[model samples]
Target: MTLYRATAPHGVRPSPNIWNHTSTYEIENRAVDPDGQLAAALREVASWRARTVLDLGCGSGYHLPWFAEEAAQVIGVEPHPPLVQLARRRTKRLPHVSVLPGTAQQIPLPDASVDVVHVRWAYFFGPGAEPGLAELDRVVRRGGTAMVIDNDGTRSTFGGWFRRGYPGVDPAAVERFWASHGWSRRSVDMGWRFTSRADLEAVVRIEFDHATAEAVLAEHWERHGEDSGGEGDSGLSVDYAVNLWWREY
Candidate 1:
């Protein structure tokens, strides 16, 4: 019944798009990276100013404006039609920004055109992302930096929940995959701080399968209930770990 079901690209792997619901995903974006630490670090390393930047899998273009503020030009590529539309609308006023419907496997940009490429919670995770990585090799210019921000499911409370929700994922294997690919990892503490229990629950619901979501929520409540005053408290914070994997070519 989701809008993405009809318009999603064929022969593409399903992303961790949180049940394909954009509204909840927006709440998640707001709850994450409250201090702008991730952005600051990325800017420090990539230094996109006066350069052309590409945001692959840029759903809804949430970070496009920020990139446009510094980059000489910004391009957002997303496969989901509805999200691509939203991204275009979000950046309509920014003449230096463009949002196009495209998948990571087939980025709609010229070879060696981008100075920096960024993918956040998108593709280029674990197995089955070889095609996208190849595409990155083609699109990014020589000396360009490619950055991928993904959950480091090896440590932290949020990582524990992620491991419980998806037992099939091998954190060690994922780490090795990136390490073998010539990418360097930088651990980032981009935790989630929700303003209300409703926000927290909603995020959990989308993050996991129905049964897993329930189990995770129950575990969270049971562990923090007493200190949080029997579930009436609106605040919820989970220590999270993420890997900022990047490579300079």
Candidate 2:
């Protein structure tokens, strides 16, 4: 969603990738986040006060400000220049926040410097994310925790859409990879709720195929604000969960 942060031939030129759909991705970001589930769940585990944090594949730097509010310093590494620029612009006033152009596979951070490493949908979950994992081991300090949040494509309300989007993505294998690495998990529920039906439909269109998008838009998940049966994903209805995995050295 941080298309503005993309640079060079990749950022300068448009990408067919969903992240390139900055507008829809932004809508999805707002729609998917109901009550700050990920943030709240992370807070439940531990506090980040005065800690040095790194956000891998940080998008628009939306979280950098929050990290700055509590941590002594927060650094965001993003490969996309537009997102890097946008993140930079977003956290320009926050001295503790810094956004850099980078990727998870080849992190630019020094060894054992980060107290906490947080990555969401940014980290690639296929069979080849090992380099990123090794880099995670390299940058995170001892006793520090790293949380990698990926979509639970195995089962959920919107699970089918995710499966269809990335047909070969194996959720089970990803869990196994993290677990074998000695990371523990904590599942947190989250959902998507859009104020406008149009916005909801817009987000769905970008998330799935036309048929799938229309089908999702037509279903009434739960009783929303004003209307009892509306054409939008309801926060209370969708079964959203985040797998918070961590480890300590």
Candidate 3:
């Protein structure tokens, strides 16, 4: 029951899709990585159990509770005021979980404050994310690990769609950017599974522009036919690939 706000935070880059259509974004969050492959990969690289975890750009605090279940302390930093309030309200009952108003470029926490920093689809895109990366270096302890989850626009069904939707993003250039920065990447194959076709459509619409959305949905319809949610069809599922970028501080 979270409300959406039109007023975006000043001096912070706004995520238009999520800021404008929050409920739909929530559905997208639920629909992503249903098998928990990303979570498994993250734990394999750096386990947050018993450590202080920081969730950067934790929209609506959806992942905060999950991190709170294991981490000794969970801190969620978000620039959007409304989202900050939502995160705080969501984690109000959790004594160890705290949601703070801050941006990745200028994190409010002190130096070497967190053990594990988890940033999923947030500010760490590629070349322009150096400031955020610097903040991570400052906040993460000596032995801490920082992980950034971003769309791998090289392979997978959704990768093709991503390339088509955002033609500006070069997968090779992004790879080089991470490699130059000394961050290791593990490309993981993940899939989006929605319970209903309508839900799938809604999620896709938000992820892409109208033309791209229509084209993607039409392609899906053509592949799976009108009755796509049937047993024979792949139903409301899409093969998505993501790069789990990590670096030890």
Q: 1 or 3: which has the higher TM-score? A: 3
Predicted structure 2: lDDT: 0.71
Clashes of each: 1, 10, 0
lDDT of 1 by residue, 56-122 (tens): 8888888899899989999999877777889999999999999988888888888899999988987
Ranked by TM-score, the better of candidates 1 and 2 is 1
lDDT of 1 at 164: 82
**Local accuracy by lDDT, each model:** 0.83, 0.71, 0.87
Best by TM-score: 3
RMSD list, candidates in order: 2.5, 4.3, 2.8
lDDT-sorted candidate list, best first: 3, 1, 2
| Residue-level error in angstroms, candidate 1, position 182 | 1.0
How close to the true structure is residue 112 of candidate 3, measured as C-alpha lDDT?
Answer: 94
Best by lDDT: 3
lDDT (tens digit, per residue) of candidate 2 on 33-134: 577887887877666789998998788776788788899999998777677888899899988888888777778889999988888776464356777788
